[model samples]
Target chain A: MNERVGTTVLSLTGISKVYGEGPTRVDALRPTAFEARAGEVVAIVGPSGSGKSTLLTIIGLINPPTAGSLLINGEPVITDGVAVANLTTMRRRELGYVFQRSNLIPFLNAEENVRLALEIDGVPAHQSRTRARELLESLGLGKRLAALPGKLSGGEQQRVAIARAMIHQPSVVLADEPTAALDSGRGRQVMELFRDSAHAHGAAVLVVTHDHRTLDLVDRVLEMEDGVLSEKQPA
Target chain B: MMDLAVRDIRNDLSRFLLTAAGLGMLMSVVLAMTGIYNGMVVDATVLPDTYGGDLWVVQKGTQGPFAESSRVPALLADRIRAVPGVERTRSYMTLNVQHELGDGETLRFMLAGLSWPDDLGNSLPLAQGRALRQPHYELVADRALGLPVGTSLRLGRDDYTIVGITSGMVSSSGDPLVFASVSDALRIQNDLASEALRLERESRVSRVRRSEYGRDPANLARAGSAAPLPVTSPPPVTAILVDVAAGGDVEAVKASLLGWPDISVYTIDEQRELLVRGVIDRARRQIGLFRALLVLISAIVMGLIVYTMTLDKMLSLSLLKLLGAKQRVILRLILEESLLLGISAYLVALLIGELAFDLFPRRVLVQDLDRLALLGVILGLSVAAGMVGLRKALAANPNEVLAS
Candidate 1:
């Protein structure tokens, strides 16, 4: 499957992050190299304070790497230590994010929450609404389209968040503990959704998680320890 | 942006409306203050408007007839009318008096005396019945006092019939106007009290004369017949009103009147300035201060409310930023909500203002132009208020989403 898909959706070389300088200086992430090809779902498992979040944020273009180069869809977004253009626009065009909590806008209903991303991208309102409804229904949230975030249960909220993340079909999707609040069964279901998202939409999915039970759903598994990353071996 | 704002307000419609209504009530008070000032101006000019006089001739060195007391001869109207370029002349007198209804309801009224002949330019415009036609015992009262035609009331030992009724007739101080013949007003205001005093003095003198010569009736009759008591006449009028001939130079007429050392003349413009700047100066300042205070309170209240709403949505806004929303998107959203709040409050304020105007004891005049101008000001101020919330929203950090 990796041989069939030759394009790299996200790639990073010598990526490093430093908090401050001198005595207060803290290296959140050491210089590292990473890549994710099209049609692959990669999982990063680590203990707390392992810099998994910092690495994900740098890859997602939320925080610029202190020393590195980043490429999305084979296009250079960051060279050396500076961004080429507007990072916000770049993030909106190429990246999708799902946080640990559902983080849905409480005022908006499920469909509206999904449509907001497209609306931010300057999509026409009518088209955005229709696409949001279709995506939510595809995720088995058809009846919950008009329900506000507070009205939905834990699993439903996570599913709505998933729909929002995948609404724009970006080149890469970065999710941090996407199902930390759900039970084991629901967590596995969400991980399977990520796998399907990568294969069906050809998106490169990167998820940071502690749930080892859903490791079988990803094409490759990596481990982070004190800001360092290495591929995991088969059990 | 509008759609998003509309939905957000609809989601919490009760909270949004309550905030808007509170703001609207404050704005209504602002409107009421403005209306009160307008009403004061109207009241200040109502008497002059009713008289329609081009110039006023009063005692020298006086601002009469509203701002100061002036006494001139009643016969001056004839001389003033004879001056070149003088179209017409009418001697007028105004006495501020309290009419005791005998029920603890003492109503302040302006008793105005106008020239006779029952013609235009001298009589008040009646809303019902006829103008004052009788010389000594007729009155035309303002309808605001609820005085009906044919109602008779005693004024200074004389029963005067209400022969006419006029609307919108008020004094410079907002007292209702009551018009009567010049002689009737003069006698009622000046002669009646002096006449009573004179009779009492004569009676006392007669008694003293009888006491001194009680033993001799013939001597007493001779003394009473030999020395007659003196009579007191009514005091002169307050001012005389003059009209300029068609297309006449009012300055020429005024200059001619200045030659008379005992009297002064004023054009319409001069009287208006005296009334607004001099007469009502203190009240205007008070009203202006109240308006400024209300506006300041409105801005603070509006800004605080929007800032609080922004605080409430801070978390959600941070999540949006994390999800890749641009700063403009978030800023637009907050601004749209602020605009909606402002417009809604203005609408509620207009309704409340109309209701309050009808119930206020004094006149509250709300003009259409005034309302529109107020609305524009409120909307603009509301937008200014949005900046407070916009700043809060902009200061939201997207990294908070990860921290949570």
Candidate 2:
């Protein structure tokens, strides 16, 4: 699996996540197998508490599965049994996260929020600012760069979050309900941004959203139930 | 790498400012206490240093002129001058009394007796005009009292004229020193009233006897009526100021005065030390208490701030952790916030200390080094406080968020 310009960008085989111990243990995500390749938007759909987030978390490398292989870009990072610690540095440099609520830091302006990942990546100030400006402009947030999180509308905040996630040009972008806070029109715009960004960047974009109306933007739709995921839209 | 403390402070300016203000007030209080003590010590030794004496002889077992009552016989200077290595000795009658001015203002003045014309013994090195030259009439007063030259007032019984004023001649404990001739001061000290006025205040029977009897009543006759009234000699002179002879062995001379019954001897340096320590003791203790309390308050406030901040950011911290933010990154953020709070409060404290010192009644006398020292102290305290917050932040479990 090569997350960047590869056939399989992400692979999860025999992945399981359990909570608690002994009698109280819950297998949130049962042993599962899935793959998302380059230039694809994998929509992971499920009812609340139906293990959708668990599977997404496992795939996103935010939560490691109890038993499985999590291969990224053809390399086995989490193989058969255990997660390697050095994956954190890799994830930060190569992966981006977007939450449902836009979870933007309140103090920073939209541009600074977008530039944060670059700064964390040790990019020089002038170059990071230039890239941040360019990215925000491309995302139609040029005028809103200096506006704080509170000043922006819900749709704009999500757009800023999207920009922040994609600004680092990560090979994999994981958005959990990225359009949940916006109206239908704004939701449609957000879905379009992800689709366009994924197509242009040639990176695998995985989004777990309940809004089926904008499912057209995704290249693949996966429905999850009781830790099991099935392809709703065939390849 | 990101200057987390500054960035966080910038994010919530109002919170930072409010914390700074609170710490500033505490710093001001600490500064005020320090100033009061410094002023007191300065006031206590001003007289001893300005008087510039090599030796002081006062009554024995007394802390000397300032701490307790001290006296020597008025004529004791004659004997003291005869002692080997005695340079020059001056006798003075000093008594603490309040003077009521014509303007209804009362001031505590030390009646300093002197013999003038020669201006040998009782003289203030004139900072402004000449010393008091007239023996019986003119007076010299401390310049700290704000009295102009030639200002005169009636003290006790005599109507004295102020001919000159001197600077830096005030006595220990802030009493204005009044320079008058020895004869005049003795009159006020020993012989102000006539025989008639003395009898007038006695018992009616005792008061009438001197008038009924012969004008010069015999001692036996006087003693018969008054139960052998022990002659209470003039309240012995306050203290005798002594100057060592040119190339005088001051140590040897001081050793001789120790044998004199009911008298203590002190060099100028020793007197100044006693005076300074005496005046500053109480103020020192009070200031020390204030310093301790301010430090405790600073520590507590910083700790509370760190704790509160950690609690507020717990969810975000957990989210970051879940996103594979290493514990070191989390640790850095927690440490940064803690330090940010401490440094902000320290700056606030410094400003407050400056303002408080400026407005306080006494001279605060804060130097640059004190500021630097205080800054160091604040930094140490801040880091200590932040540790409390950092501990809790470190303990926060990313697994907690997933539970619910």
Candidate 3:
């Protein structure tokens, strides 16, 4: 195990979300407490409307929790339900996300799509290009760097998305069903990439998925039910 | 950073260029409207500019010869010459006439008369041939009339040869000007049909018999003669153009002419202003309103186009925002694309105008300043259109990328 595997990089305490008011009020999350340490690939699995995505959104910093203290890299991001750190800056510098689909800009080539993340962080063009090429090559996409998203296969596109997510070496990488569109064999490959990203780069990888075939590749599995979250033991 | 706007355009170059071409055609029409108004002003003032006179003396209380009718005594030129600062004077006459072209076509023109032996239209810009050399049968025709030099035109009872051709010499109303001697113009104006003359003679005979000399056969015979009676006084002229001597004050000469209660005097600049403001003011306003409306339409259409384009990129933009792309970065992308579209459309408009403006029936004077001003307007329009797209882009929900 990597030495950084024991360090807690993301922490969420008593985080909950509710919609509307009065009789229309409904709980989306039930005071969830979770920690994702560096060099750990954690999976959150649940059926539809089970609050898994709600928890993911909160961890991704895309939605503010109704009540919570959230921290990243030992710094307070959201304290007692009030955001103390700039959310946009933290999202840019410390957080990365991969969606179900590749979500690459269609007009840009594969390398350019990956380079866009670094470019958004104000990286120099030449340096970003070099890093983007290296990342894509490491993801087995060196031959397809000049291909647009439309020309790349589903598995190849997902790999490019993974490269894009890891380009800035973010502390926490949130993925929402990163392998849902791939076949079982290709799905396992992508899950393995998440494992590699966590172990080699010391990133706290959290994937929200329904795919079970790749669950064995993850370090831990957390299951959600009825807006409640709990750890599930291996069979 | 990579130019996101340019990359998008290159990815869909054919569609982008087609859109620009459509916008270019609309912009060309807007430019043409401006040019037509400019052409109208130039046409209204061309005569005054070419006449190069210091003052114009017309009938009192009237804006003569171009904007309104003002007929003064033809000999008024002589009286105007007596002013202290008046260096020279020429009798100016104008009449609108229509002649059959022998092909079911009627040629309508403005007949402008120049004083022969004194003013043979030497001041006119002759594009071909020479000015009127004879007092009775020579003419100077504007090129717009489509009459070549040496073409003889029959007016009234005489045939006049086109001796000179002037280009761009049209009246305030856009009618081509045909120049002739004062004598020939007056004869054409006064020429009467034979039957009308016969009736007038008989009426004169009856009036003479009814008078105290009713029984006098000599007076009856004189009235009944077959020969046409001679006019007792000369025909009236439209106005008198005056030139002031060097180191002379034109206002003083104009004031002296204004002293005559029967005539109105105006400086050369005032004459041009009368033609522009009095003669073509309504037309200018109409064209101006049309130009303004076209600019507004261009803005609206461009805005809608930009909005639609932004909608097309909604997903991609959402993904970028979700990836922590700055708001300003996305704004720059939209603004740059809008500017690029506007600039490309403007270039296309200029090309269309250059190739096609002359084909218009009326003169289209596309001035450089007008082009520069329009470019500024297009830039403004581009920015405005970009704002429409930027609003949509900024409101894009980055969470939608996750949903998708």
Leading candidate by TM-score: 3
Please give the distance, in angstroms, between residue A189's alpha carbon in candidate 1 and its true position after superposition. 1.7
- Give me the iRMSD of candidate 1, please: 1.7
Q: For residues B29-63, what per-residue lDDT tens digits would candidate 2 score against the true structure?
A: 66556655665666566556555668988888876
Per-model fnat list: 0.53, 0.19, 0.60
Q: Write the per-residue lDDT of candidate 3 for residues B273-328, one digit (tens) a residue.
A: 88888888999899889989999999999999999999999999988888888998
User: What is candidate 3's TM-score for chain B alone?
Assistant: 0.93
Best of the two (2, 3) by lDDT: 3
Q: Which is the leading candidate under DockQ?
A: 3
**Predictions ranked by DockQ, top down?**
3, 1, 2
Which has the higher TM-score value, candidate number 2 or candidate number 3? 3
Supply candidate 3's per-residue lDDT for A193.
Answer: 93
lDDT for B65 in candidate 1 is 77
Per-model i-RMS in Å?
1.7, 3.2, 1.0
Please write out the lDDT profile of model 3 over residues A1-235, one tens digit for every residue: 4567769999989999988889999899999898999999999999999998988888888888999899999999999888999888888888888889989899999999999899988999999999999989989999999999999999999999988888888889999998999999999999999889777777899999999999999999999998899998987
Ten residues in sequence with the least summed lDDT for candidate 1 chain B: B226-235
